[model samples]
Target: MRAAICDDQPQALEELKKMLLRIPAVKKVHTYSDMNNFWATLKDGAYYDVVFMDIDWKQDETGIDFAGRLQEACPYTKIIYVTAYTLDYVEDVFLNHANLSGLLKKPVNQEQLERNLEKILREQSEAEGKLLIYYQGSHIAIPLQDILFLESRLHKSCIVLKKQEYLCNEKLETLKGQLDGRFLNCHKSYMVNMSYIREFRGREILLEENHVIPVSKARAKEAKERFFEYMSARM
Candidate 1:
């Protein structure tokens, strides 16, 4: 996996980078002393699978704020906060709307770093499959990772994606049977891809692309429980 490290402390940044390089799973590692340089690299179309961010920036902007902006530009990039103030900033980091993968305490431990990396890699592997459906006149195979949610519409199910939708002549229950744990049946008529969920607002779920999915009153509690379980497993 390709990775980036953003930290103002030179020694800390290099230490993290060196540890990351030692991991065989990590193919490339980039270090940045300034947040501007990191943003500039992203703007230039550079992509990293994960970014190790420092929560406390000495400047006017904090890492949490910068991470929010980074999510806007690259929604798929996973963020891992590396900080000494884990207790102080932990709440804020999770509260923010970012694709957070995990967190690491400062003066990083090699074992903890590897565990986080392995969890992400395992998730990516699990997400590597396709949903085959007959759409229009041809058969379509949509990557499971790209799907946002599935909505039941009368006799058909609408497979919603980031930029496209497909009508499949299958019942929501039948489709749900084929999906993995990452897909949650939050409502009787809706099954959401947990990876695309931005927030859970009681009766409604806010998706990454600004789409909203209703949560049935009866299933709201289960949805919240499953979502938290999913998050905890990854962390």
Candidate 2:
């Protein structure tokens, strides 16, 4: 999808961009360090499928103002508010807009970026979340939003997640397609959803759900890229 990230923090913006590269499907990702550049791009009719805005930027216009203007300009493009400070009336602020995708708390992490990301992208994907898992004697439908990561162990595969793991015979490739870009291949044997990710240490990726998945020696770069793209869209 075509998307943009708008924030003032260079380090944070760079980190967000880095994570998004892991996904092979992202067509375009534009990063803006401040609102002026971003607003100019929008004024020039540059639209994105999604836009991530840092709510507390020092721009003359706040993210809320930009979002409202964006709603008037491009109603279809999803608006996601990114904030470092805790917001009390997030819903009220969103109500004035046309259609809001969702919000992200700042110092944005992978999982947080991904959680509501697929939620917004679900409609954008040609095929909305179609991940079908056969587990516990029934075909358990795993929404892209609920997934953590899929782990391959030896000849078999294990699904690691927050609530529970459903043993399945499905291959990662097939499931990955159903996922769209919300989940990515971080390791040869491991596929992860960016929404559940917390932090990516040298080899270990922490999940907000508290599970730790190892980034394989061969897949570390791809893993990092996945995180970057995901966070970039999050802003």
Query: Candidate 1: misplaced stretches above 4 Å?
Result: 129-141, 144-235
RMSD of 1: 17.0
TM-score for candidate 1? 0.57
Worst 10 residues of 2 by lDDT: 169-178
The candidate that wins on lDDT is: 1
**For model 2, how does the per-residue alpha-carbon lDDT over 72-163 read when each residue is reduced to its tens digit?**
55545678777877466476566665467877786777777776667766765643564555565554556667778887665345777678
What's the TM-score of each model vs. the native? 0.57, 0.49
Give candidate 2 misplaced runs (Cα > 4 Å): 88-92, 126-235
lDDT of 2 at 59: 50
Error of 2 at 86 (Å): 2.5
The alpha-carbon lDDT assigned to residue 70 of candidate 2 equals: 73
Q: In candidate 1, which residue pairs get closer than 3 Å at backbone N, Cα or C atoms, i.e. clash?
A: none
